[model samples]
Target: MSDTFDAYDDDGNRYAVPVRRSYINTSDLSGPGRIEGLPSFHLSGGGAVNRIDDQTFEIVATGKRLTVRA
Candidate 1:
């Protein structure tokens, strides 16, 4: 995340700007998983909710990030 402002658009008409952009950190999870009984798991790739024993697992992520191994 990095940005600077001065592209003009208040009456100064320069509007061809692109700032504040920096993202490249993809590897949210790796192979090995058994979040049974809700030990510890909170995926941020957009979907992962598991609670074993009472049984409830809702894992959804097509935006990329899926690794589960038991």
Candidate 2:
């Protein structure tokens, strides 16, 4: 699994923010594995998750501080 981040309005309205994307290997999501190559935004604090489309998704991580845009 991977993660990504986007800015949203206070009313939960998504805006045009730079879409940050990261890639995590399959092994990373299997069991208890470590995820590498994360961005600084994810490293700050709480992460986020969003549904991009029917088959696509965005996972933000608070653990390693990274967002995987899948």
Candidate 3:
């Protein structure tokens, strides 16, 4: 089974998780792009989420690292 998690910033802002699309799963060309109710690691603006440990993550963008709670 797959586990779902929510990611939150230090200030308690919730990020909308995105459903990843790949070449093998391209049949649904016009479906909802985000996974609701889950926290997003991929920032909507820019940046990538890095796993620090269980329940903790780091947002890296523009040479800055911000803490994220997961």
Candidate 4:
């Protein structure tokens, strides 16, 4: 099963968001970097999961770094 927690940005500051992903299988929440309007996560096969909202994120990685709106 999975659980949810609060949301936070790169800084140690907390956000007003809820339902954060709580990994139970492993503890590897390493992210590549934050793009302007893209995701801050990087997959092994050049993929990313951009955070659109508190519970809405999309993949937009083409094996390369993407620069969206910070």
Each prediction's TM-score versus the true structure: 0.19, 0.19, 0.41, 0.25
**Which consecutive 10 residues in model 1 have the weakest lDDT in total?**
61-70
Model 2 scores a TM of 0.19
Model 2: per-residue lDDT, tens digit, 4-63? 344443345443223355656545445654455543332223444454543333445422
- On TM-score, the stronger of 3 and 4 is 3
Candidate 1 lDDT over 9-53, as tens digits, reads 233433221223334444446844432231333343323433232
Give all candidate RMSDs, comma-separated: 19.5, 10.8, 8.8, 15.1
- Candidate 4, 1-70: lDDT as tens digits: 2222333434343332222233333334784443233224433344444556555334464222222323
lDDT of 4 at 34: 34
TM-score of 3: 0.41
Tens digits of per-residue lDDT for model 3, 10-58: 5666764333333333336676343334344555544576666565666
RMSD of 1: 19.5
Q: Which residue ranges in model 4 land beyond 4 Å of their true spot?
A: 1-39, 44-46, 61-70
Instruction: Rank by TM-score, highest first.
Output: 3, 4, 1, 2
Task: Assess candidate 1 and give its TM-score to the true structure.
Answer: 0.19
- Residue 59 C-alpha lDDT in model 2: 42
**By summed lDDT, which 10 consecutive residues of candidate 2 come out lowest?**
61-70
